[model samples]
Target: MPTELPMFPLGTVLFPGEALPLQVFEPRYLTMVDHCLAQPDRLRFGVVLIARGHEVGGGDDRTGVGTIARITSCRPGGGARLLIGSVGEQRIRVDEWLPDDPYPRAVVTEWPDEPSDVSDAAAGELTDRLAEFADLFARFSVRQGRPALPVPVWADLPGTDGDRGFALARSLPIGAIDRLRVLSAPGPGDRVLVLCDALADVVAALRFRLADPGGAE
Candidate 1:
C-alpha cells in the first residue's frame, strides 16, 4: 500500500544507510520540519533527486524513486534556520506526487531490494574494486591541484553485505545521474554490477589523467 510522505527533492541522491544533514531555511521546508518534529514517532520524510531545477524556491522535476530519511536530531541554525540530522533508512517508490501545499508530498510505497545471494568472494571483490577506485580518484584530484578526497574506513562499514554495498555506493563521488542508477538498482547483486561498471569507468579516466596530465587520446 502507498502512504503519504513529506518529500524533499535535492540536487543529490541519498542512499539507504547514508547520513543526511540539511539546513532548512525555506519557509516550506521549515514547516515540514516542524510538522515532523511534532510527531516524534513519525519523524521521517522522503528524499528524491531533483531531475531538474534548483533545490530552493520550487519548480523542479523530481524522480520517482527515493530513500526514506528518518530524523535523528533537529536544532536551530543561523537566523531562524534549522539544522536537521537524519539517516536514510529504506528505499521507496513514489506512486503519486501530491501538491506542494506549503511543502511537497507524495504517495509512496516501500521498495526493498529483491533477495539475491551475494557470495563472500563477490563482496570482497566489490570492496577491493571500490578501494582501487577511491585511491585512483584521490591521486587524480591531487594531480589536478585539488585536495584529495577522503576515503571511507573499510572497518567501519555496515554489518551485512547488502548494507555495506549501499554504504560503498553512497561513498562514491559520482554524479547525481550515476548515483541515481545505483539507488534505483533492483537488488544487491544488480547494484554491485552497476557500481563495478561505474568504478571501472572512473578508474580508467583517472588512469588516463595520471598518464598524460593533458587528457588526450
Candidate 2:
C-alpha cells in the first residue's frame, strides 16, 4: 500500500544507511520540519533527486525513487534557518506525486531489496575494486596539487553484506546519476555489481587524467 510522505527533492541522491544533514532556510521546508517534529513517532520524510531543477524556490523535476530519511536531531541555525540531522532509513518508490501545498508530497511504497545470495567471490571483487578506485583517486588528487582523499577502512564497514554494499556505494566518488543506478539496483548482489562497474569507470577516468596531465580528452 502507498502512503503519503513529505518529499525533499535534492540535487544529490541519498542511499539507505547514509547520514543526511540539511540547512533548512526556506519557509516551505521549515514548515515541513516543524510538522514532522510535532509528530514524534513520525519524524521522517522522503528525499528524491531533483532531476531538472534547483533545490530551492520550487519548480523542480524529481525522480520517482527515493529514500526515507529519519530525523535524529534538529536545531536552530544562523539567522532563522534550521539545522537538521537525519539518516536515510529505507528505499521508497513514488506511486504518485501530489500537489506541493506548502511542500512536496508523494504517495510512496517501501522498496526493499530482493533476497539474493552474495557469493564470497563477488564480495571480494567489490572490495578489490573499491580499493583500486580509492588508490587511483588519491593519486589523481595529488597530481592536481590537492590533498589525497580519505579512504574508508574496510574493517570499519557494516558487518552484513547488504549493509556493506550500500556503504560502499555511498563512498564512491561518482556522480549522482551513477549513484542513482546503484540505489535503484534490485538487490544487494546487483547493487554491488553496479558499484563495481561505476568504480571501474572512475578508475579509468582517473588514469586518463593522470597520464594526460594537461591534455584535454
Q: What is the lDDT of residue 6 in candidate 2?
A: 94
lDDT of 1 at 11: 95
Write model 2 residue lDDT over 1-217, tens digit each, in one string.
Answer: 7899999999999999999999999999999998899978779999999999899999999998999999999988989899999999989999999999988899999998888767777777877887887788777777677888677754468666678778877877889999889889888888778877888898888888878958232
Q: TM-score of the candidate numbered 2?
A: 0.90
lDDT of 1: 0.85
Clashing pairs in 1: none
Cα-based TM-score, every candidate: 0.86, 0.90
Q: Per-residue lDDT for 1-217 in model 1, tens only?
A: 7999999999999998889999999999999998899976779999999998999999999999999999999888989799999999989999999999979999999998888666666566667877898788777777677887677654477676567668877777677888999889888777777777777777887787788948532
How high is the CA lDDT of each candidate model?
0.85, 0.87
Q: How close to the true structure is residue 64 of candidate 2, measured as C-alpha lDDT?
A: 88
